[model samples]
Target chain A: MSAQGETPVSRRLSKIKHIVIICSGKGGVGKSSVSVQVALSLYASSPNARVGILDVDLTGPSIPRMLGLDGHPVHQSTDGWVPVYADGGEARLACMSVAFLLKRKDDSVIWRGPKKNAMIRQFLSDVRWGELDYLIIDTPPGTSDEHISLIEHLSPVHSRLSGIVVTTPQAVALLDAMKCVSFTRTVSLPLLGVIENMSGYACPCCGEISNVFSTGGGESMAKRGSIPFLGTLPIDTELVTLLDAAAETEQEDDKPIEDVEHEGFRLLRRYKATSSAKLFGPIVENILSRLSGFTAQ
Target chain B: MIAIQQPLDVPANAPDHCPGTESDLAGKVDACEGCPNQDTCASGQAKSAAQDPTMIPMINERLAGVKRKILVLSGKGGVGKSTFTSQLGWALAADEDVQTGIMDIDICGPSIPTILGISNESIHSSSSGWSPIYVQPNLSAISIGFLLPSQASAVIWRGPKKNGIISQFLRDVDWGDLDWMLVDTPPGTSDEHLSVVRYLKDTVGVDGAVLITTPQEVALQDVRKEIDFCRKVGIPILGLVENMSGFVCPGCKTESQIFKPSTGGAKRLAEEVGIELLGTVPLDPRIGKSADYGVSFLDEYPDSPASQAYLDIIDRLRGILGDK
Candidate 1:
């Protein structure tokens, strides 16, 4: 299979230890945000683990902006094009997205099937991701061309390729998310678990938790389907604001801060600490444990 | 190649066991090797074997009757593209003389059929093409949802297949002389968007697009890209509709910001993009209930704020299309 026409991509991905794909059947379910947070959490938890995030949501590339690496371009090297690197606390995280190649941030990519397929192929094969512990891919919604292409491209190269289905706590979303679960099963991709995003909203002023769309749908869906339930992420307005601000900040030289005296940054820092401690922390731990179990096997 | 010892004059409607069957000439056409028209006959047979030779022309002829095409698009998913489309169809069909048709191009998660309460009916095909399921006398609809075997079945297809089916929906569906054709596309500026715009614009010029978004930065952020898509493709922007702007409690009737905007909401985004803000729809619980039960909220709760907003939006849209 490596000697086939897909040799370049399969050979390129052969170096990665694990490739985890985050997907959902429905759009606007915070799938991209979950992918970003999961990658960040993985980097924060592992001391020496090398992580890379590949935003394959070509038409709606959000990872570049979400992680403050929007305008960064891909640099060419002898091996291939090197991915852009951003400091993730103690570890360095590599990122790649088609957004960086666009002339404008608002430029829409109106591409057809063959062109998109070629682009995804180039993204997989041309990006020189040097020995990494994890390569997390963020795909657009639905179990269509992009999802099938990614699974087929990565499964032959990496044995540890798995999928994490993201969903909101609504029956409509769950109904579609179930198709994502079935998609993974049909493709024979390993199921890491399911993460229910925007499960509940915690009031920023009074700290009262409200079920924005009803909370237990995701957990029940996971249980009914016999898949592992990762955890639920509360709808944090402060986190949304912080991420938006981070994307807008133009300073490329800005380093990760331990503690800031500025009021807004301080609040952002506090929110990150609390939210990760409460939500993303456990989710990342469960994912890492699953990967470790797979490695052991 | 197999040698053909049989005659070339085979009857078109001959029985299976007839002397010179059609199947016998399939590969045994080597006998016509010296004939001048052999190339033409072989090529014609190949074309016919593939599929109908007039698929594109058939689609063009079918859509030639549609006066205006308005695509309902959004960059972000789950922003109620289908629900809004269903409501807009109902609203437009309220006029006794107006004729409206909806083409659900969201092949993967086709919710239009279910939302419009026509999911149980299967599409019927004629010599012309597949006939659209009529939700009302004046309002007809078509969706991939109606073609599925069951509600649990999923359409796991690639780009080319989806494109082909979407083209068929436009060309093959029998939508005759529609005053307005609302095309509901999947989220993002990808395959479905490109296909719908190409087919509709090439057949009959598209009127424009109606963008939908929520009053949240997360949704508005992606909708900005959608607006960019419309501009790049040369599709005029009719306006933007902000759905679920605020949630109205049924008990207290007080509007509260459920998904508050971190980035100044849709109105600010519209201002930044230089487009008109058509209307804002409050998050009414009744809308969801009606949508789930496959009924029209405007007809059930005409006095509700959300329904009223839809009416206002419909009026503005009619003004733009000059349908009034």
Candidate 2:
């Protein structure tokens, strides 16, 4: 464990092997969900691999809610602020977010540029992530202060800093997603690939895959931008319901329930079987293969 | 300050290309062939000289024409700040006596132009200043969207540049004698929000802010901070607007909670903050289509449940503004 106060970020994050930032130029394209799923999928694929999910979407932190860690406070030790750990069955995933620091789950963070930068810096330097194989950072929409600050802060510490841009298969979303790709290029960050989320919706009753927004936009974007096309995630309402149920159940932790009996727990199990979860398998594999290739270089 | 050079008069038989009318100034044709000041204009140095100084007095002078200023803000993205602003503008303009103008300060994602059906309208610069494009008889707007050469062109600007443009939007745009001026801000409480609140406060004094949020706990959580921001900055919050509260199924008209309020919803949030919950607008598919097609849902579907909710919200806003 690294000592917390006044320690340099590079030394603090030196143990982390790889850092992947999930970002989108446009909001509401399921960036946070993709980040969470990727982190979980990485953990699922390699049970021994240490995964840490950092929700740096300071103003709008949704990773905590999605992972059922909302209202959990970060603990401070002699090492640093300890992140909350979520049990992913055989493997455990550590989580840290600004949402944990707020008094209420509904409290807003009305911070300016300097404040946001400072918060991101503190999250990078202060969190006691320990030695981890992967650190997935979820950022807010656009290439704003958070994006620049995170990249600038991590470039000195982590050489294997890569980015995964997320976008829906819609022209309007792709228009912004292209900017995200361009932003990664301008920053000189290595692009792992692009994930087209909410590409289609599988009707539970009809058993038909309906094109919700549109499909193949992200694949074409990846080809045009010369980045790897990761995969497409379908819009799964069950996943949303599972996330909401988890958040509610976790907030009501006073009443302990058996893991097998918890509704949220059951819903999460069902969520892991959904098409979106299956989509994450290929995306995670692509990201790992790309990272290995980079390491070889 | 640079001295203003008087332009030479056009000859009696010269072509009808004099830069006198609004159309001539707005059009692409250059009519400065024989003018004495053409040299300075050709080099674009005079344009800088004519730029409005970003001072409090200058902004106040420009805002003096507007009777009331309302800022629409949302802490969470995709919560429909631009959609609500456009609808509010249309609803306010529905009254023939009321004049409204929307100033979109969302530099990166300025959806005002597209939402208000004025995406093709060009902003014309005159000797006075830049004029906002009038989308309707009673409604006009100014946005960073209009400044872009194409819709696909992104405004990849940093904080200071965005602040500069927002200040310029308020100080330079010719929004004359508006009964109401609605300032639509980007999601989050960052540079844009601070700039709009600070500028409005120092210049014309903002009436209040209408905070928008969805019913989900994820959105309500951030919106709470927005309210705290208004209080901390000494700006009164008019009320809270719960958008996309429920989804009315078109088949049976049964309202369902699409994005359920895991944290007790906005009504509870407003109670905790001791503010008014203006109204809750159900999720309507047409609303999305309207925004995409640059049409006002309120005008196109006046009988929509969402439109009625907006009308009620507007009524509450009017009550807060003491307009009714």
Candidate 3:
């Protein structure tokens, strides 16, 4: 915070059209996958919607791995830290993560709350987002520390800032996810909706939806709260393999083809074949429609 | 307002050879340089040593009856930390004579109450201290969720407040005589993890920590950090439990790779990190359903593959602990 009533974060983020955060109170509910797919969907919806993802889960940063940008480094410039573009130099999907700061992929970031908060504050204040249409913040599982810091810094963009709660069908996951919805309301951040991830497991051999984890927990929570249900996402083995495979191998050795590039989503070319991209494409379009209404208001 | 505080067992950011905060050389040692708690540990230790040196002794006295203390930890959230804790409690309590206690310190989202099937139970003050809700005659547990007015509400607390509540839980709870005590911690290596090790390390002493993770590079990546966190704080690593290892299709009985283990999952991770791979529990939908319903999946579906796997892991765990 500065004496002039504007933070460096707000000033740096001023160029972004809308910032939506993807959060779930529970971990392993696919927060990272959803964030990545959402970024791809937004960029795929329109070429002009430049996107950036800020991975804030300091202890367990999967965004770098999810986007196949694990070994990528964040370059510091005269303005601040320059985010690594998803592809080569000209791509639109920019990203900043603590994973880039580590020398090894498996290195641990062992810091207490105050230290984690300091890094988070620096992430918020120092990253140069350039001109992003949407900057989706990927948060860890909690309503403490990083979350409080994020809401504090982004308060200036509260109206343009929206929150999306992700959850699964299990009672335990939904039990905590319901609190996530209430948190957005309590903080006065506009609620985009609730997404039920891992709703069911589609068997690879049989091609049958197994109801493995059951379904509809997120929708019921959304219905009870009168919030829009963003639709359920089944456990996509296809999406899992696409991202997981890309994560295992080194990216950036392949030559770029002209024109059909999916900005920010390095793996979106194959991700489109996954059921997640197909399901998320329309969900994002719906969100953008509602977002347009929000901005218009 | 600063009376006296419990010094950290080993602050998270402490150097390799950093002495425990209770040490007279806590803030004075070379390893304590750049430790965030150096200032507080220095002045607080000096004040407590002068004014009241009984704090550690009192905490030690409070936790005296617990025979063994273990922490269930995972660096990533929602990786079945609470589920494993609850099931471990049930498995230990399966014996008619063994008494077990579970302490859930995941303040922001205390799902232990829900997972233990005690979501409706509330903590009560007893003559001795706070009475933990007994789910069974042998199994008892406590969580901040029990203190909440409703399960639907979020505990929007900051770190200091979380630490305060954790301290109070330790000081006020009468765990009584128990054969086993399992503390389920929230994900990440931060305030709660440090606080648990801080209060319990020098007092009753943590026997070890059971690391849990799904078979994925991302989850494995975090578990490695957890391994480091335990090593840094001097907590012995019991082993790692791989939950959601692979999903076995109920229809075809064919196991599918829900989370592809591109980096060889926890098996390779454990081998690489030089820790024991206790066991991998395959994904069973009934396990999640049971946890949500707050019942013992081990009891309901003992014949199932997941249950047997859990039993085998528990047997290995008992053997490992028994020899020690």
Candidate 4:
């Protein structure tokens, strides 16, 4: 590998190609879930591509719980703060958050802006993150200090960092997302697109899709602002169940959640596959290409 | 020489100069309780007392230098809050009659310096205060963008903290007497907008605020919400400007509304909110192109339809402010 600490554009910069921040303008849009899926999507396309997910939300860090990574202590060694590997033997995929280092996972991090920026900077510089194809930063709701600091600090290095803003199809969410788009554009960052999460919900008994957050808010906002519109995600209770079950399963067990033997796990995979193929695949490819400074055909 | 020799015997006895204790110093400070500079000295000492305690007085002192606070908000974002702010600032500066500055509170997505054609190297600070780069001869501007590391970084802020940051921007910046201060707020009636309005209402009164919107149903709906917010806060509505209302075809000079033409977005909303219609910006390619190229359309194409429309808006705003 090229010696570490090279400039972001240098050929020796390694596996890390771009940093994509997955955020929401308002809360309860499944921002973390979308972030996880985006990280996994990048990995699925290029399995060996190094990837890191930094949960800067501070308040609602769902990576540990969602990935079924629980009770894993973050390893601190001479190489810097090392993210706990889920599979242990397999290559590490993402970084563990400061949330995991706390005695209690649910405690609030009441840090001021400068210190928050300092912590986020530590997450970037102190972490022994190797060259990776992508670093996904999942941020909480609203435009405020932490988000500004993350974007400001990272922008100088990652010139091509694109944003995947998630919003529900509601007036409030769209309004906030619209501000988000303007905010992103103001700084001259390429708006990758808007993702409409919880676009619809399907009742298993009725076998019919129902508008959950009122569909088309994202598309309308995108159309109005002229931003690229990413595909929508339906609310699936089974996916939630599978995620919960995955967290409970032992990492090394033969019946691990990824094994697909679990019915809920199988259902989750099928849903992800269908959604990834139908909606997220193209969006991911487009963003990755854009950040890599390549035009899509 | 003879006069100096007379005091030599007493010169050997030096005055006692023992360092005072903390309590003794506190007593001395208490003794100056009613003095005008007492608070300044006390707070200055307190700031150095801790590794990084809240330096309340220093921060308050920084706030005293601000002048001419303006709030640039829209019922919606795509309607051109950022665009209007940049253009209005440019227009003010273009005219030798006024000096202008802008503070972008759109923390989620700051674009002030960018629209003003400023770069990372352009944003600088000095002993005087954080210096805003002059976009026009008399216009200086700052945004959360200037403080950012890059456009791609995520701005993840919450409500209360967002308020604190806005306050800091207002009170901390060394904005010397400005003819006008334009604040570009994030869309919606959220904490960002509320923070700016509240700060102006509670601490400093705003002269007036302009609302930007397009002729569209979705934008109109949010406009009503924003209007209600302003009313609740008692912030005076300066006027409403319709942006991107009708697109004029470059080939034929034929105007067409891309989202169905209706006066409802700005005009009707202005009437409903009991405010005057400032003006309408035609759907001009030059505006978009100028924003893309980081130059105000007025500067690039002085006679363009968009530029003319912006000039008209400025005229109306001047009338409202009695800038005869």
List each candidate's DockQ score: 0.29, 0.19, 0.40, 0.07
lDDT of 4 at A282: 77
Error of 4 at B4 (Å): 72
Off by over 4 Å in 3: A1-4, A248-253, A257-266, B1-54
Q: What is the lDDT of residue B173 in candidate 4?
A: 71
TM-score of chain B of each: 0.83, 0.84, 0.83, 0.78
Q: Per-residue CA lDDT of candidate 4, range A235-263, in tens?
A: 65545444434454444355654554333
Which is superior by lDDT, 1 or 2? 2
Deviation (Å) of A97 in candidate 4? 31
TM-score of each: 0.84, 0.82, 0.90, 0.49
Clashing pairs in 2: A106-B221, A108-B225
- The sequence of per-residue lDDT tens digits that candidate 2 reaches over residues A154-257 is 76754678889998876556766876776677667788998888766544544555564667889998998788988887767666666655655455555334
RMSD of 1: 7.5
Winning model by DockQ: 3
Off by over 4 Å in 4: A1-297, B1-68, B261-263
Model 3 lDDT per residue over B1-324, tens place: 000122334533467776766567778878778876678667764325322447577778888888988899998887889988999899999998899999999987888988889899888887798899999998999898888767777766567667766776777788888999999999988888888898888677888989999887778888988898898899999999999888888788888888788878998988887999999998898999998899999999989988998888888888889933
Q: Order of candidates by TM-score, top first?
A: 3, 1, 2, 4
Q: Please report the candidate that would top TM-score against the real structure.
A: 3
Candidate closer to the true structure by DockQ (higher is better), 3 or 4: 3
**Per-residue alpha-carbon lDDT of model 2 for B194-221, expressed as tens digits?**
8888888877899889999988776776
lDDT of each: 0.76, 0.76, 0.82, 0.62
Tens digits of lDDT, candidate 1, A268-291: 244356564457877888999999
Model 4 CA lDDT for position A222: 83
